[model samples]
Structures are given as C-alpha cells and as structure tokens.
Target chain A: MQGATVATYDFIFNGLGLREWCGESVRSGPMTMADLLARGAAPAEPQTGFDWGALWSLPFPSLDELHKACAEIPRSRDLTRSLEAGFLNVRESLRFVLDPMTQPLSWALENALHVAVNTPWWLMLMALLVVVWLAGRSAALVGLVAAVMGFLLFVDHYVFAMQTLSIIFVCAFLCVVMGVPVGIAMSRSNRFQRLMIPVLDMLQTLPTFVYLIPLIFLFSVTEPKLYGIAIILYAIVPVIRLTDLGIRLVDKEVIEAAEAFGMTRHQKLIRVQIPLALPNIMAGVNQTIMMSLAMVVIASLVSAPGLGVLVLRGIRNLELGVGLMAGLGIVLLAVILDRVTKAALARVNAAASVARH
Target chain B: MMDRQVSIAIRHLYKIFGANPVRALEHVRAGTGKDALMAQHRHVLGLRDINIDMRAGDITVVMGLSGSGKSTLIRHVNRLIEPTAGEILVNGENILEFGETRLRELRRKQMSMVFQHFALLPHRTVLDNIGLARSVRGERRADFERDALHWLARVGLGGQEGQYPHQLSGGMQQRVGIARALTSNAPIMLMDEAFSALDPLIRTDMQDLLLELQTELQKTIIFISHDLDEALKLADHLVILKDGSVVQQGEPQEILLKPNDPYIVDFISDINRARVLRVRSVMDRAPETIPQVAGTVDVDATLESVIALSGGDTALSYAVRNRDTTVGYLNMQSLVRALVPTQAPRHGNRKQEKAQPAASGPAA
Candidate 1:
C-alpha cells in the first residue's frame, strides 16, 4: 500500500498518469499532465517533501550562554524580593508607630471619653430655618422653620435632632479632611491609584455592619469616638474616590496648558486641577454626607446620639409616634444638608465660570 | 539679554523614564545614547535632544500628531516634567535650575496657558474661573474680580461672568478660557489646541479672536495643534514633528512654499495652494517705472480671490500690480496651470476624486 501510495505520488508529481489517461480519450489531443494540473486537475501527492534533519536540529543557544546574557541584569526575582522586603518593612514600621502606647495621648484621651457634644436644640431649629430659606423664599423658610420647630417643641424631640446634627458635623468634617488628600494622592499617582482602588472598592461593597465589627474590637463599645470614627470610615470612601476621579477627570489638555504656562506642579494642582475637579469632588462630598446620615442612624446601635438614636429608641420601645417624629426630623436634616451643599457647589461653579470669563 | 527680550531657550533636553532613572540618565549621558537608554528601560522616547528658542511677540506653533512628544516638549518648558539632560532658559536664565519659589514666580508673572477643553472650574462661575490665577497669586478678591471682568470684556464675555460654564456654548467656554489666560496678564501664553474641541465654525471664530488678540497683545504665544491649517494660520514660526523629532521648522510661508521633507509635503497635500500662497509670493517684480492699468489687484491678494474675478473675457485679463506699478497680468491659462494638482514625487499620482458631472434637464 505504501509502494502504491509512493507510485501514485510520483505519477501526480510527474503528471504521467493524467497525460496517459488523456491520451486514451477520443477526439482529444495529447496534453501534458502539468497543463492538466494547471487546468485544475487533482494532485496525486499533496504532501511531497520534508527535511527531517532541519526539523530535528532547530538552532538554539545553550542554557549557560542564555544565563550569561541575562546575568548582571536587574532580575525579576531580585525586584520581587526587594519589593517584598520594602512592604514588610513598611508594615512593620506602621505597626510599631501605630502601637497603642506610641499613639498620641490626646487621641487616646479623646477615644477614651465616650462623650460627644450634641448640638444644642436651637441648632436644629437654626438648621430648619436655613433649609426653609434654601427650599423656599424668606417667608417660606421662616414658616417651614417655625412649623418644624413648633412640631419638635410639641413632641419634645428637638434636643435629639440637635444631637444628630452635631455628630453628623464631626463625622462629615473628618471624612472631608482625610478623604480629599487621599483622593488627591490617588489622582496623582497610578501606583497609588491601583493600590487604593481595590481598598476603596472593598470599603464600598462591604456591609455597613462590617465596619462596626473592626471598631468593636479596636475600642470600647461605649466610646463616642468609636461611632464617630466608624461613621467617618463608612462615609469617607465616596469623597476620596470621587476626589481622585474628579482630579483625574480634569481635562488633560487643561493640565498641559497649565504646565505650558509654567505653573509649578503644586500650583497647577492647587489652582488648576483641584478647582476644576471640585464639582465632582463636592458631589462626592454631598454623597458622603448623605451616606454619613444613613450610617448615623445605624451607628445609634453603639450609642451614637442623633435622630438615629431616637428612631432606634422608637423601634426598641415600640413607640410608633416617637419613631415617626424622629424619622421626620432625620428627613428634615438630610434635606437641609443636601440643599446647602448643593447651593454652595452652585455658588462655587458660578464663581469659577465668572473668573474664567 | 534685556529683561523683556528673551522669552524661552531650550537646550539639549532629554528625558528617560525607568525604575532606575538615575542609571538610565547616566547611560544616556554617557552617549550609548537614546537607543541604549530605550533598550535598558523599554521606554518610549518622549522628547529626544530637544533644543528650541521661543522669542517674545511670536507665535511658535508646535505641529505634530498625537504621541509625537509635542505635549511632552511643552511640559518641559515649564519644568512640569523635568528633563533628563537639558537646560531651558527663560529670559536668558536657566528656568529648569530654578527653585520652586522662583519657578512659581516665573509662572505667575511671565506666563499663562489656555487649555483645549476650556478647563473652566465647574464648581466656579465664569468670574471666579478667570480670577483663580489672580487669587492664587494672592491678589485681593475685589481686585482680582475687577481684573477678571476686564479680561472677560476683552474676550467679549463681559456680561456672562455670573453664569456657570455648563450654561455657555463651547465657543463661549473657549472665550472664557482665553479670558482666563488673559486675566493673569502674563506676557507669554501657551495654547494647546485651545480651539480644537470646538465645532469648525466656532473654531474659525476663535482663531479669528486669537489673531485679533495677538494683534493687540502679541504675548509670545506657543500654540500646539495637530491641524496643519491651524498651525499655518496662527504660527509665525512652525515646528513640524514626527517620531519625537522635528521634521522641519521654518516660517509658515517658507514651509508651505518649499517643504523641507516628504512628511511635510504629504501633510500639506490637500491645502488650496491658491488660497495659501499670496500674489506677492508668486508674482515676478517688474521695473518701478512700468505703466500701470486703472484696475490692479493687490500683491497680498490670494490667487483664489484673483480667480473669482475672472468671469468674462474682459475680467480674464486683469493686472497684477505691486503697489502702483503693473507687475504682471494673471490670465486664465496661467491660473488654470497653477490650479492644476501637482503630484508629489514620493507618493505616486493621487487620482483626484472627480466631482460628479451635473445632468442636464429639459427645463429649469
């Protein structure tokens, strides 16, 4: 069968078989098999030749030679080892620095004290006045504030609203102070961005209850700062992420233009980049404040004083009236904060536009 | 050099990006050079051995396609990206060597830039956006506002100061950008395709505005654009870059008339030569005493304008005069020959896209 196959292959290669077949046909002139093949005749041997020696001896440098070529280079292994060492050192130093004894006395003291100053009840009334002013004209603002204040006064929940307001202020402030720089840093460096983004993603996706778990272990449950810190962490991610995103989103052309004008890196960041990124950052801040409000109520589980506590109190005691009033107060606070920040953002955008002109 | 004379001088700038930057820089310095450096770091050469001198009152347009290092080149002028090996002189002083305070001062006093996307602070009004640089430079709010208004008025955005950028049209936004740059009162302005983002019509209008502003202020502008037309229109001196190196640099007219490289010739292929070339450029000078005709076109007039004048037989034979003397006459034959597309030598004859012939109708 192999000899037949080789013979058929030779016949196809030389075109003798086709020519012989054609010669026997009547009323047809003798034609070469090459011509027949050229005219689309089938081939006998599709696989004609192979070089076994060339295939067996594919040229390659020796392993030692390759090693010599690669030596004295910055090896990936060395890089990996150094990186690991650096990270280990950083972690160790962080642990040492963050040791309980080494921590600032003031921070420890503040953490130890379970007391947080709740805003006076008058502040809630003040907030209502501002909210009224923003949502409506002066008369509407006054009327709304009066109605809310009168309702709270009648219900005797004014003090609880004030307490919620104060805690929200402290938590929101800390969120801003910490979140903005973290956002800026993330915006500035790709490595930092890569490192922080996953952390941020984890923070964002983790259940709000999960935050209390870590805090519960780190500090006493009765500490006021515990809830404050928890609320800040819970709400801070949005601002930080947004700040980074906003700054990154600032038109690259604009940054280039700023640099072309000979603006220093710092000047450009502070003057050009940050200002442009502010709207999104503020939006982030707005979202954070909203989130903080959402968490404030949950934080009431750990004695965070606010309308949250009142609502919790209402739920625990099954006081439908108390819960309803407290919920209403929280809504009022949320609206007030939202409106004010938005108004402030509007004002900022307007001023920036005007200055641009 | 006098204080006001020298604008910027860049000398032998090099930048190498790597984990071991110092080693890469040293290797570059040792003259195994750009190739070796790139080999070592697997880095793309952003700007290689760049040397440029920008003068006061001139618009030097850096024309290059994206990633040609035009942006990187401009960034180096301000020390935004530090050069690996180079010196940049601003007013004869090496600005790259300047400390932070001096650099900031130089930027605050001597330069301003307009971005392509009209980087108006979205959180601020037009007034505040223009006033930001002033505020950053520590100007009083009231003083800055007044100055900003003046700039707004200059850019024809006098009454729109209170509106947010979102409320304005793209053209108006760019005008605000121009105004923002102007508000700083810096002598040097860098515009990186500042009008590139706008629609074509608005871009033209903005270009006209820039020209008008240049006429008034002449602020040693360095504009970057990928569009050759924009570069030709606005630039006194044009630098055409390809592959992180300058392909050619010359006056726009020179580059247009006699392109130094095939790349530039290809770039300028579609330009209406009749429109771009002036009558003075192609016209042969005649004797001063030659008799002149009653109707003569200006030497500065483009061939397109001259062609439009050729309607009937009488209009066909118009005089091309230099000042008062009739230097030459532009007939239909010469005009047609000039208008006929010339094939570039390197790229074989490009068959022009033929206009579909209009079909005749029995009635109008």
Candidate 2:
C-alpha cells in the first residue's frame, strides 16, 4: 500500500497527472518510444512484464487532500523567509540609526534646539564643576575641571558644554536608576532573564542613529526633552547588562552561607549578596557613565550641547582649534567622571568589607 | 550521662533534589533506592535515612569518601540543606521548625563551621575576617576586634591580624578559620575536613592543636574526613558512612578492635592499630617490686615511644608510676614484641626468641 502511494505521488510530482488530464489523444500522452524519436528524448527500454491496470488504478490522494498535505510546507517555508526578512530589516534599521544617510534635517534640528536651550555661560561652567565633583573628588580632577572650564570660558563655548553635561547627568542617572532594578529582576527570574537578554543585546548592538529615527518621528527637535530621551536610550543598555551579570556572578556558596546563617532572602540580598556583588555593579555603573559620555557626543548631532558642538563646528567649517580644545575638554570630563565613580565604587566595596567584618 | 545533652540528633533524614521531593523520598523509603529515583527524575539522594547523634564535648568524626555524603551530613546539621523527611533536633529543639530569625540566632550563637577549603573572606584582613561572626551578631567593632585578636592568638596566629588570608600559609589560613569559629564561641564546631587540605606535617600540627583546644574548651565537634588515620587520631567517637548510610559508629578503640563490617575493616586496614591502640592492649601485672628508675614513661605512651626509651636493650625494663605509686614495670620483651618489624618474619622471629630469654628474669 505504501509503495502504491509512493508511485502515485511520484506520478503527480512528475506531472503525469497533467498529461492524463489532457486526455488519451496524442498516443496516450507522449510515449517514451515516440518522444525519443520525435524530440530526441531518452530512448525507452522495453518492459518484460507490465502491470498497466495496477499502475493506472492505484489509489491516490484527491487534490484537496494533496493541498492539505502540502499546505504546512509552504507555511513553514514562508515563516522562515519572513523571519529572515525581519532580521534583515532589524539589521538595516540599526545600521541606519548608527550613521544615518540624511544629514540636513539632523543638522537643522541640532542647531534649532541648541539655540533654544541657550544655557548661560556661568551655568555651563558650574555644571562642568559638578560633573567633575561627582566623578572624582581628587584635587587632580578638580584642577582638570577648572582648567577645562577656564579653557571653555576662554573659547566662549561654556554654555554649550554645560547644556551637554546637564543632559548626560540626567540621562545616565535615569539609566542607572531604572536599569539596575530591571537587571536585578532579570537575574532573579530565569524566564525574565531569557526574555530580557535578547532585547538588551539588540539595544546594545543597535545603531545610535537608528535610535533617533524613532524619536524623530515621535517628538520634534523643539522639545527640551528630546535629546534627554535619546541619550537615555543609547546609554541604558550597559548598566542593565552589567547589573544582570553582576548579580548572576555572585558566588553560590556565599549565598548559601548567608541562607545557612538564617538570613531572610531580602536580608541576604541586602547584606551579603549585593554587598559582594557591588564591585561588579559599580563596574557596570562606570561603563554606563562612559557610554553616556560617548552618547553625549552623538547627542550633539541632535542639538545636545557640550564638547560635541566644538567637534561639529570643526567638522562643518574645518576649524581645527575649536574642535581640538573642545575634544580635550571632553576627554578631561570623561577622565574625571571615570575616576570619581571608580573611587566611589572602591569606597563602597571598602565599606562593605568593614560591615562584613 | 544525660541523653538530653545530645547537641544534634538527626533521624532518618532524606535530602532529594527535585520538584517532587516527597515522591522521590517515598521511592527511597519504599526500597526503590537511588537508582530508581534517578530514573524518574534526574534527582540524587544527597543524604538518605541518616541517623546520628553528636554529643556535647565529644568529637564525632564522620569518615567517608567523596560523595558518600559526609559534607552533606554536616551541612544538614545547620539546616543548610533542609532534610526532606525526619527530625533534626539541636539541643532538644527541632531546628526544622526554626523560622529565619531563630535559625540565624541558632547559627550565630550555637554553631560555627569550618570548611575544608578554609572559606575565609578574601578581601578582609585576618582581624576583620576573624571578627566577622561577632559583627554579624551586631557586636561593636572594638569589642569584636579585641575578641578576634584574642581568639587569633589562641589559634597561634598572633601579630598576623593586619594580613589578608592570601598572605597566610595553608595551615595559617586554616588556623584563621579555627580562630573565626572560636571567636563566635559557638558551643558546637562543625569542622568539615578542616586539615584535609594541608600538608602532612601541617596537618599533624593542626590535629595536635585541635586536641589541645578541645581539652580546654570541650566544644562539641563534628569533624569530617575520608582519611582513617585522621579520624582515628582525633575522633573520640567514629561514624563511618558509605553510600549515604552509616557503615559503623563506636568509640575509636571499639571500632579498631572489632569493626562492625568488612567495609569498615577494609577502610581501617591501613591504619597502624598498635600505635592507635591503648595501653590496655599489652599491659602486664606488676611484679612484687619494680626497680627504681631515673626516667619514667607515661602509661598512655605508644609502643613506639617505649621502644625509643628502651634503646634496643633486650633486657631493658622501666618503672611505670601513676602519680606517686609505682604501678608496674614494662619489660623490653613486650616493647620489642610490639615494635619488631612486621614485614621481615626472620628478623621478627629472631627478636622474639632473643627477647623471650630476657623476660624470665627481673631487673636489678
């Protein structure tokens, strides 16, 4: 029975049924012997024993059954094709965001927002000092900040730098505040970790320019919060990823020891697990800050201020002096931020040690 | 003599890891055993039907190879791994019923454990690490440090307070671990193969230190080791486990004299029984009078020590005194008989023949 079914299937697949539907005229629909002579097709071999009745009267599936049987094949194939297309679309969108092809609207929006914020020169200098203070408490950091502020003042780009600093501070703070809990939640639940990991990976690898495209569609350049939102989206991924990693990497034995000591889950988390995991979390925070700084420069393309304007100015008019000084100021700010947060992390870990003792 | 003095009592405890622990445990209780349970669910019976008692001021050594559930057994005492079925009574109180706070309090005040690997907090100084248990109990820093320093000195780690665990030798690290446990002042100390990771020389030193400490503190101790020699040396009572079941449990001398089963006999076969055995094994009644001697050996000294003092003299004799009274004499014949090389039969027989003649006469 299986063999008979296979024969019918082969017949249908080879278009033998189409020939039958065309009717028995034309010598039973193109015999191998006649076709070989007429059209030089392959020569036919003689059959020793032919079961013509068995061949013709075999039970075969109806057209509806065939359609039903083969239906899932195309459906699965289409699903695979669509999935590939979706992945391509995602990749393309990310590429577009990272480095957009269209420059004029981006440039115009950047300039309009910059003019509207128009932060005062003194406020910008103060913001720079605050950035320096928050990042590092060292005299070296303070001195570096003072010198950069003085140079910014000397160059008359103080207002732009402060506008940039304010946006970065707010965005980075929001990222840490929001990302850490989400990361913790992700670490706690396997289902949540599985679901969030891919999304975080996509966010991390997505092009920065692609992020602006969605925001550009959602909010106009005139809004003060536009750059703020953009900066947060671009920089939030590092902290989320790092926080998840940190909590997951906490030693199982330590946690078990804490539990053995009769610590409540919350108490263990607060007193033992998190304290032990703090170094990694702080390292994550440091990465988040660095990433925020990196995005601040790109945020400048959208009218977010700071050293980015000097860079933009350098690019547009080929003014090397303005760009070089601003670049130096940004580096100084980055160093100050990196050092201060790291020092704070070190202090926290030290305090945790003291408490553990 | 009070049964109520039993510090920890574990009865038929079962720990099976799976979503269906009861079913797994029931399977075990029903004689399906570990293999059947593992077939249904990829679960292991880490501990199975474990019944034991750790008494006050006695060190019960749980001797087993790796995966025989020695560590698991110790962990269950503190409820680190909750037993599936059975009661764990610590000081007449079933700890299975202890809530988080009470359990924490029990761990803080009643029990302290030392791991084989010496699980010292890596980032903290020796002083801070030793003081951690006190701080966890909410003691003030100065008081905790003072106590930590005292305990550190007790463990022979004085003046090493400022150093980190990494700076210490393996033996010193374990000493710090002991000090940390001591600083907690917990009545029961669970030492899980505490000296198993140290060198032989260091291990012997640490064992001696533990014996000295135990003499003074009289802390209830549950020590785990796979080494029979170690168990024989330190344990007043010995519990041998195999495949998560108790093979034997008795006083060390009792186990050595007559092991309950061949498994235990094989386990302790390599042990130097004569060295580990007591004076009761080879004692002889005193003659009417024993000759006075300048030096006297303790009755508890091993035959090896007796041989060392006899100086290869076939006719040597010693005066054995208990306090002021001369209890007896130990003849060189007995000492030679005990210490003669067991492997060389000809030499052993020659020594035995030579010593028999000396035994017929008393010393001047």
In candidate 2 the C-alpha lDDT for residue A163 amounts to 55
Question: lDDT per residue, candidate 2, B1-364, as tens digits?
Answer: 2453787888888888788888777777776545556777677877777788888999999998897789988988888877888899988999999987888899888888887777676666889778767777777879888788998999998999999777788899999989988998899998888899899999999999999999999999999999998998898778988767777787876777666554565556556755776543344555666654536766667666666677766576776656776566777677556443333343444455357633311110
Best by TM-score: 2
lDDT of 2 by residue, A1-357 (tens): 211122234445336435444332222222334224534433334457886865786555653223222322132344556876776667656546744433433454455446435756667557656765665556776777687668766876666666566566666777888898888888889999999888988888899888876665545565545566677777888788878888887766556555544456676667666666777788888888888888888877876666787798998999998888778778866876787788778766664443221
TM-score of every candidate? 0.65, 0.69
**Most lDDT-accurate candidate:** 2
Runs off by more than 4 Å, candidate 1: A1-127, A131-166, A181-223, A256-275, A283-357, B1-42, B48-55, B84-87, B131-134, B141-151, B286-297, B307-364
Best by DockQ: 1
* lDDT by candidate, in order shown: 0.70, 0.72
